[model samples]
Target chain A: MKNSFSAMARREAAAGYLLVAPAILLFLLIGLFTVLFSIGLSFYHLGQGSLITSAKFAGLDNFQNFLFGRDLNLSRAFKQALVNNLWVLLSTLVVIPIALAIAVMLQRISKGIRLYRTVFLLPMVTSSVAIYYVWQGIYEPEGTLNKLLAAIGLDSLIAVNGWLGELHTALPALIVTVIWGSVPGMMILYFAGLQTVDPHLYEAAEMDGAGAWQKIYRITWPILRPITVICLIMGMNGALQIFDPVWIMTKGGPANATEVVNVLVYQQAFVNGDMGVANAMGWSIFVLTFVLSLISLRILRDKSE
Target chain B: MRGKHKWSPVWMLVLTMAVILTACGGNNGDSSTGSSDVKLTMWHWKVAFDPGFKAVADAFKAKTGITVVTQAFTPDDAYRQKLTGAASAGDMPDLYAYWAGPLEGAFDGKALEMGPELEKDAEWKNGFLPSALQGVTVSQANLDTWAADEKSSDWKKERKVGQIYGVPLDVGAFYTIYGNAKLLKEAGLEAKAPATIEDWIDTMNKVKEKSDVPGLVFSAKTFTLYENWFMNFVDYMKNGEESFTNFMNHDEKLSDPNHIHAIKIIEDLAKSGNILPGSVSLDIDPADQAFAQGKATYDIGGTFTYASLVAMGMNPDDIISFRVPAYADSKVPDAKVTPFPLVQMVVTQGGKHQKEALEFVKYLTSEEGQILYANGAFDLPAVKINDTSKLNGSLQAMAGSLSSESNWWSENSAISGKIGQPEWQTFHADMQKVILGNMTAAEAAEDFDKAAAAEKAKAQK
Candidate 1:
């Protein structure tokens, strides 16, 4: 009997191992290989002839170059990218809250709420490339926006070109696009969070003579804190890693006004072919993201606890 | 505790075995097991070149029975990223198309020397124009007219500093300008194109005043429009000296009066309501579309625009070319109108199949291949072919007119060295500012000088 029981347990264990084996193998093959190889490559000088045939060890030289190199202005680019990322982050924080409020209001309404949601989320469902093209038309000097300004009798203020050309306005213009693109997702998250809030708490607050603003501030906010934090962190991370929109729309143009860190890293790696420096930059971005996420999580955890 | 204990050793054993398996599988499949045949994999971004290139590959295969695989990348930018990544990862294709200039600097010492077959191909050697050869040759040795003694001659005096590293596939000329004849007729102007910048401006103003169409359209989303304008304006303003000299020689000062004047002209074009409003938001494709749809009178573009316009269903006859004229009052005697090359292809040094690759390259640059490209793929042939009867009507006209011009240049040629220069970008932005009435031309010029000086200082280090 004991021998039979032990045989059964062993068979079950073998079956479990077999089930997970593919996943483990795939993870190691795709994810770990690049990570380990990149870590190894970080220590070597990868130039033209030496790319395949030879590798010379130069410990931390790549990192040193990233931090302070003569040949590459990585440090300056990184600083500028970080500043651009921060702009995106701050803008998202401001915009998402307002979008969430609008979403919550629309959710409460019985009529035309579906229409509102559909219209609000229309930009999200549309392809980014298409959206950028449409915006491009609207932003043209004699395009709809300028025409509107002229109609309003602000002809002197009618700068026909989009905000992309001006260094001062380019980042802000991109931020508006990012905010417009991201709000729908955030709004949906907030709506889901609102649905989970107990009706009794709101009723109790209302019974206590709490106004709409007061009730929201006192009851709804505390309950939605977790979702808000998630939204905030994800939004910031997304904004930090913004590459496609900036790449397609502006290409970090008008003098690197829209140059985020990812754009810089991409240019360094692909455009410039400075892989070693690029890898270092990638690692730096990874570290920055990890640290930022951790800090955000810690603050959230503390508040929740 | 019991479950955890059971899982620990199992996980360890599984991980170890997986590692071993991965190590075994990590071998790249490039190593030939027993096959003596050499297989070359070539990647290119040109979809149009595929059929012609495939024919050459087929011929090579018939001769050697060594398979040549050709892969085309969609969307050139994505292909470049992939190629760069592959190059860095030591897994690049055997032969691939690459751009010259700053892109060439990326793979500096890493390109293959062509074999005897290519060097001995007399037809290929004699077919290419002198300027086309200059664009491809990177080394002094490969040049037709190098200094007699390398040691005695000044480095600057050397005819060429690098070998002919790439096959001259196409002549990327910039003199081609596309204007909508329909728009011109609507504006009550004759089909005759403007001869000078002043006349061009006058015609544009008249068009704007008389018609509903925008005067001109260009993408202000990036510096492409600004750069293109600057390229032409620099030629006119400096009588074709300041910007080109500054770019070629690192030691030359960038903040010359001519460059500043060029910036002023671009700014004036923007400020004077000549350029389409909201151009900063428009990109190349949309801008081209605007021109094709008769929304704009002129598009300052290249030979590729002809193909694009035809693809958009516009009649080729309606799209006419005009040469941008010299400055109305210029001191330089030999100033000629020129435009920049759009693209150039090079082979990287890290490639394995150098000999076979060079053979393939030689085939691409041959007169037969160029003619094929010109006929089927819409490429402006690099070589001046004897037979002009087979050429497209517009191209034939362009070819006829091109010989009379004295200057030939690429757009990026002026600021080539200052590609990554931050001040160069600032210069572009300042030009925009000047056009917006935020700064004067002189202020813009001073700013450019300061930026150029800073860039020069950085380069010196």
Candidate 2:
């Protein structure tokens, strides 16, 4: 095989390998190694302050503990977190359309489009921890949201315990924050997609007596269906792995109403120091996320192909 | 041309490997032990205590000609994460601070056993409060409990029953009630902590009546103070120590009338509109800030709270500290607050400078060092200070609150180990609801009892 290649070809091949070597090595060392290590860690019981070398082989016990109710508290927390993740995923139905609507409006605007876009993108650009703190203030008992509601004579609707403090309202309050943070990125994606849509389609829709709503329903939506699918996938992945906002805002508290898989994984790993179980929970969430993403892709796939 | 560039791939691989190795490797920063330049690193999560630690470290270096480097990580949870990462990497500092109780087990294999050294040096050993040492010591009850618990295999194996692993940095309790003297005087009440639970509430009511400020404030969102310390203290006052033990051991239920009464006391206080508004949303620092800013008439905290309150700009002269007051007609009316070690300084097994680290630990708990720390940080010391004038006014007040009483639930070795169980999560959540008036105290107590039963069953399995 070496003799089959010319000297010049061999030289080019060597150069190519050299150019990509760092990236390949980095991917193997940091990315693949950690994934493989955590997967292996799931099969072992490693307590805190003990090295990985001292880990005892536990077979499937770690997974069974949470998944099979061997540990009731862990199982209940895991199931509740799984349900919360699903709720977050379900919010994409509302999130994508709102983002698309904003994008459409931005596309139609003749002035200050940049300013509107920048204003809308501010949350995306700002530090998420800072934004969570800001939102925490807004949802506080004496926060702006409750005060605004009271000012408008809707005093009965106030959450006296604060939005994140009430069990009934915590998850929804979190979901709203999640949607607000997520809308900006999806809006930017949709805006880019809308830019590629030819202006003549709107003109054609108008000639056919299609109103603005009908124009969007019949033309814009169909053309942007692929973007919608992409947004749904991104949203699903983001929601499933969402940790920082929940951690900063509620800490999966008010009776674990805002608990998600990542928060549970964090608690198991760092708080409880049950590395094996934490890794098991992490891999389990990964499997669920993969399956959900794949199913959504299959369902959203165009049959015309 | 190919031959000229042949070493490029090999060179790049070497450089990347070197970079990764360099980044992954941690240096303990220890040199020859006898050398004057030998430095030992210590880590802790006490934000307000950083300056005090620095002053002590500087004094130690001047006395011994050895460097003691100190690093402070804040907010507690982040420091736990840091320790977890360091432990996994086998790169823990020479000395670090850790919590006692269930959390001490996590550092079993890593922390150096200082028992033999303490036993040998009677002068140094006797310098610390006896209760402080008892709190850090691994008792027979700890051994039995760890052996029985399915999750405590590492703890049972690595930690011996009759040995101590760390030195107490401070002895404190979270059940202390602090009153703002300014607010008390403004309400026309005595500028002192109320004598009993009823008295406290009555004082709070007076403050509310005289001014817009609430009667009481605490880190309600954190819930540990309300659900654990305050609840347990009230339980002891109302039902006695044996009843408290029975409830923890599952021989008695939280739904019992006495326990429900304890829960109802907290509920009644909340119902009285004495708790600060939006308290359910505030954690420790924010609640402290609210108290310091005079938004509340009184705050509930521990020995550590005095320093934190003073640091937050509250005048020490304007604050009165006392134990979480007992109930009127209480079973143990004369119950005094006994101090228990909260944070412990541990020498890491992986450190190169073990002797120097041990010496640093000794100096940190020495009388002179305690005075420097207590006066500088306005924090309580584990070691008793005969010279009360050496401590700040707030620190002295905190010190005066401690006694030799050992009949409380906190002092019970068997019950303390069970206090951190998972059932408390349900209890804490319910306690929040009880404060918010969404659930009756009896209902909350029933839920806690059910949760505890479920936990007990799981533990049995």
Candidate 3:
């Protein structure tokens, strides 16, 4: 019996190893290769040569250029992108909370919950490029938004055609579009998290003479903490990596007011043919994201404890 | 129990070994080249060139019997991004199209040389426009020349200022401007185009007052529109010398009286409310659509706009092409307009079939090919083979008028830097600022000078 037990344990162990082997191999092949290759390529000043034969190692020159060089416009672009992303992050924070409130209200209502959820979730499912185009049309001078504004007698107060062109309004314009597109998904997540809250705890709180606000503050909020953390981290990461909307709608224009790090990196790698600098920018973004994620995790942990 | 434990370890060891072996085998298999068939892939952004490319590919296949695949990308910018990504991945197309600008110079060394191919056909050199040929050529010697003079270094220097790098596909003369002739006639204006800046503005003002049509439809978002307009103004102001040289060599500032005067003119037009209300947000297509619908009386655009206007359902004869006026008192002789040519096909270094590619490029520049591009697409041939009879109705007359003149220049000739071409875009944006009343004409000029100087400094390094 002892021998059989030992044999069974050993077989299970072998099966576990076998099952995980392919995944490990894939991680090494695809993930490790790209990580190493990008790092290796970052060291070289590559132009006018094949990757294998022509790339000449310049040690930390590319990194230095990206950080402190004068010829490359990368540092300025990076700063601009970071600023733009900060706006996106702030907008997300504001929009997500509002969306969650709406979702919670709808969750308590039994009659139109399905219709409400579907309507709220529609923006999330729509294509980003299509949304950008629609938003662009809305923002145009004679577009729907301007016409509506005029119909309501606010035409003289605003410049209809230059919303995206204006320095003060360009980033805000993009932020509004982004918030409108992303709020639905976060709202849905909040709804799912709210559904998981224990009804018994609310019942007990009510017996203890707790009010609606008190129940929400003590029990519901605590239960939704993890979901909020997930949303915050994901939202920050997504905002940091924003490219498609800015690229399609603005091209970081109106005098580079809407320029972001990802867009700058793209222009460097592809438009400007400065791959070394682009890779450096990529690694910089990676480090930034890592630091941010760590900070977020620490905050979440502290709050939970 | 001892026997079972020992057997279990052996089984575990065997599984680990098998996994490691499989991984190693997979890695090895993946790296090996597949089947012997030599496949050559080419990528281009020219959708209009699809039929032409197909014909060439067929001809090449018939001659050498190699399977050549061509992919055409619409909306050129997106295609460029994809091609750039492919190049970074070391999976660039075997053949691709590239523009000759400071922007393209960033990838110059990576591009394949066609020096050997050019050596094979001397007649291939004769078919291109002298100016067009001068636009693409870059040489180490030319680089040395620019490097030799410290004083001249700050001036815009081309990558290869005078070398022919690519075959000239098409050349456009900047003389043409599309106007609502019916509106012009209603304004009590003659059928003839404006001869000077004063006449042009007067005509526009008249049209604005008399007709329901707006005076002009120009998109503020389009860099090309701003460039074409600004270049025509600058060209007439400076006569024929390159604007950069005038600024750099003669201490001529962008804030010079002539340039500021030009900005004021464009701004005045904007303030007149003669432009469409939301022209700032309108892109090239919708702006052109507005023009096509006769919402405006004038659209200062490319020679290709003539074709586009006709295609948009306007009578081709009703559309008359005119030269954009220079200064108020500027004579018609001094108002000679220069057009900018879009860069076409380039042969890359990674091209496996350079011989065939060169043959294909050569055929494209041939008289037969020129005639085909000209007749089929209404494109102006790069070579000055004055055969307007083959062209469409009104275009033939335009071509006839073009033959009566000499010394036409391309706006691209004004670009001096190998990587600082975005300054042109910036210049246009500054012009927008001036028009929007965000800045004065003097301020716009100063800003332009500063921006141009900064770009020049960046490119010099």
Q: What is the TM-score of each candidate against the true structure?
A: 0.76, 0.88, 0.81
Cα lDDT tens digits, model 1, A1-305, are 99999999999999999999999999999989989887777676554222423355658877875566443445556778888988887887776778788778877899887799898889789999988767655655566777898899988766545656566777887787788888888888888888888999889988999999998888888867778778878887887788888887777865567888888877766655556666777787778777888887887773547
**Tens-place lDDT digits, model 3, residues A241-301:** 8899888887776656687888887877665555676787788777887788788877876
For A30-80, candidate 2 gives per-residue lDDT tens digits of 999999999999999876555566677889989998899877777878999
TM-score winner, 1 or 2: 2
Every candidate's lDDT: 0.64, 0.81, 0.65
What fraction of native interface contacts does model 2 preserve? 0.28
For model 2 chain B, give the 10-residue run with minimal summed lDDT.
Answer: B26-35
Q: For model 1, give the TM-score of chain B.
A: 0.75
Query: At residue A300, what lDDT does model 2 achieve?
Result: 82
Tens-digit lDDT track of model 1 for B1-461: 67655657788999999999765643223333322267888888889878766775665565445567889997866886676557556666777776543224233345554323446777777776655555555443222111221112132233345445455566555544578897888778987767666777788788888885666776555463546543544453445455455543434433455444466566667666777754555667877887888877887666566777778888877887665544565544234433222345455565677666665566566665566656665666667678877776756766565542224343224233334444555566666566556677778767666555654554454
Give the C-alpha miss distance for residue B383 in model 1, angstroms: 2.8
All DockQ scores? 0.15, 0.25, 0.11
Q: Which wins on lDDT, candidate 1 or candidate 3?
A: 3
- Write the number of the candidate with greater DockQ, choosing between 2 and 3: 2
Cα misplacement distance, residue A200 of candidate 3 (Å): 2.1
